[model samples]
Target: MKIKPNKLRSISIVKGQLKNVKFCIGDDPIPTVSEQPVKSLGRWYNASLRDKDQVQQVRQDITNSLENINRTLLPGKLWRLQFGLLPRVMWPLTIYKLPITTVEKLERTMTSCMKKWLDIPRCLTNISLYGKGVLELPITSLTEEYKFSKIRLQMTLKDSRDQTISNAEQPIPSRPQPSSERDRKSPTYALCPTPATLKHILTGCKTSLTQGRYTWRYNQVLKSLAAALESERNSTNSLPLRATNSITAPTFIREGQKKPNHPPTKPETGQLAMARDWKMLVDIGQQLIFPPEIAATTLRPDLVLWSPSLKSVYITELTVP
Candidate 1:
């Protein structure tokens, strides 16, 4: 095939330009132009030839797959990710040493998709925290699954190879050492952030979900109490603060329900409601044997209960903000 001048292109893998360089056919130099991330052979080629563009493309494709995969077919989706999507990623991974951050992000995305496929939250993946039979299989982050897959692949290849002269045929790549004379830092190893085993994954997921729910409920209760205080103040408007703490107990009732006496004859409904809500929480604590601990100092709590069952202590302070 005869190639025209406009059809030729070049990519320099080095920092400098490919100046004065040319490809020729019988002394006729072919013109060249520079471009990044040229695509060929179903992969992206870049100036550095590092395959970063290909990796990025693969990552985006994987994300798109996660978004469009059939939600109704749970098992089918699992199989697709495990058998199909994984192999696609492995092809690029084999050629390029991907950054740890990129790998982490991809793993997180996979874990999220897996959770959605199972119709469960992340916490449910760890079965140890929530007990058994909650999930059919333990959910693991993509990185762990990838590592496990790689190991299995390595084992299979090893088993198929002839053992006697295989070592002689390929020299084992030695791990690189630090160049500095200072003591080299020893490597640290840790399990993937998410649980790997099926049992533990379910338990962990449930535990995490439960804790999240608890935190949410706790916040709701706090907001309710705050709102109650605001509403009650507008309704009663006669709740008195300590003499040393405020503008001398509102000289002549600013607004709302009128007080009949100058010396504060009756307790306001808002104050009563505030006390009631606080008491309700206290009663709950008492029932659980984890009552609030009251300090013995003057002007302290009206009610305090102590529980030896839990080593944690809680204190409630009420204010009419």
Candidate 2:
């Protein structure tokens, strides 16, 4: 084997041992050995052998990357962070030893950047950002990713692989019967008459339904949608339809040919522009009564938008499920 002295560097793992270490290539003394950290495999290792510096470096890199991403002012920042920044962050987490606290801090920083990208208030809970919420978004949780990565790494180890094979070869065991009274008890809620399973809590709890819990949640969502529609209804930017008798200019003509017999038809503006007297009603604190002249229906919708001049009515029913 051949050696390149200039490309080589060394570091002692034991404290106070670097002073006694020396290297030479055929008595041409190689003086690269020191207590300072040496770069190896894209990571820094020092005499102490602690991962503090490496972790700090990784943290700094992540912070800088997030800052740079935030400054770009580009769309789909969430996607960029998820696909671009998170993978790079996960690489170090999987390769290097990092404490949960460090991962949490990094996640907090990332979460802050995500809030900016999403244009949401910081007061929003982290669970709402990563977990199932009223407004579900595609966001990854760093701590969960770290845990999964660790599990994946463990699965690749020789012991784990051997154990997995051994388990697969063994006969399947029968399902265990309830051994204790507590285990045999059917789960139930104080207010709910039925079993307190996830499905019951989410949809089938008669007590919750009668208490208006479902109605409150439905109204909350409907309120936001109605507010947005109200703004659009009041806006004056809607394109008005061209008069039927008005003539439109020709859009195009061939270089050496005469204009066509008929002019290109103007795109139809929606019925919304027909009249500006737009009125909106929402079923919130009070019950919504369907206009008698429009339908005289017993069923009430969440929202109603109508224009008397155009005789147009828009009924919207909001469903959370």
Candidate 3:
């Protein structure tokens, strides 16, 4: 049988993409500039019926994503490997430097691609081929360091025909970190608070209005918390009043956010000050007094304490940096 004719009959394996993919068969293996079948011939997995079902499900998912096309995939690459009907694939003359993106953006792109791959098994892996054909990859892998998700790829086939691998795409972008491991970023100073301290201060804040200090600044606020600490101890039950309006950063890898019912930022002078004051006081005072009323002897100044004997408020000196 002639090689081209056999190639035509060959299973047009287009695997290794995530969702919503289309596959077309042609004389040449490279799908880019090769002849089209007028319309897309549908998905790739030709031989296995079970694989076809998988291909369809993945294709539909990907199609929906592409239609919505708002989110991203990460920590993986969506790679496509094709086997030439003539054996080896040709390095086609195409532009590779498709676009530049931040580490996050590239990750999203690579994620979308992997979702493509997740949709199907990579076509280029584990296949038999005979003739020599060009592998035209617009993208090239410069460093093995970027092992995955950096838009880096290489092409190879078992048989040889005058096969060439060339890079037409622009250079791959660099990684965010020098190390291969995930970068562990600390929480933002504003969003990240010492939970112990916050409880202490909020427990104390309820007394500010009663103490004839309806409106006070940060320094006065600390003293206000001290008074609240004393009151909570004298009471039969002590618990910081639940804050009706609170804000928090909902998700990491995103910005710190105000909790719903959180006071708004408007009219020039904002509630951010109130929030800041509230957070600082609550963080500090709650630790000292934000708990069920307890026997005075069991308490310590480090975490919380009250002295009925001397009638004094005690707080471990805070090291304000």
Q: What's the CA error at residue 120 for candidate 3, in Å?
A: 16
Which tens-of-lDDT digit does each residue in 1-321 have in candidate 1? 776644555643335544536667666655544342455655565555566666787788888877767544455887787777776777565445567678878877777677776687777543432234655453335566556666665666667566763333343232245454342332111122442344443334454454453244555565576466446534433543323334645557657867666575564332233322232233222232333253333333322323232232334553432
Candidate 3 stretches greater than 4 Å from native: 1-147, 150-227, 235-321
By TM-score, the candidates rank as 2, 1, 3
- Per-residue error for 74 in candidate 2, Å, reads 2.6
Runs off by more than 4 Å, candidate 2: 12-17, 31-43, 133-135, 158-321
Better of 1 and 2 by TM-score: 2
User: In candidate 2, which residue pairs get closer than 3 Å at backbone N, Cα or C atoms, i.e. clash?
Assistant: none
Tens-place lDDT digits, model 2, residues 223-316: 8998888888877335454466778685787799986687667664665666767888898888889888788688988898998777889989
Candidate 1, residue 147: the lDDT equals 63
Q: What lDDT, from 0 to 1, does candidate 2 have?
A: 0.75
Cα RMSD for candidates in order: 17.6, 25.1, 25.6
Order of candidates by lDDT, top first?
2, 1, 3
Return the number of clashes found in candidate 2: 0
Report lDDT per candidate.
0.51, 0.75, 0.34
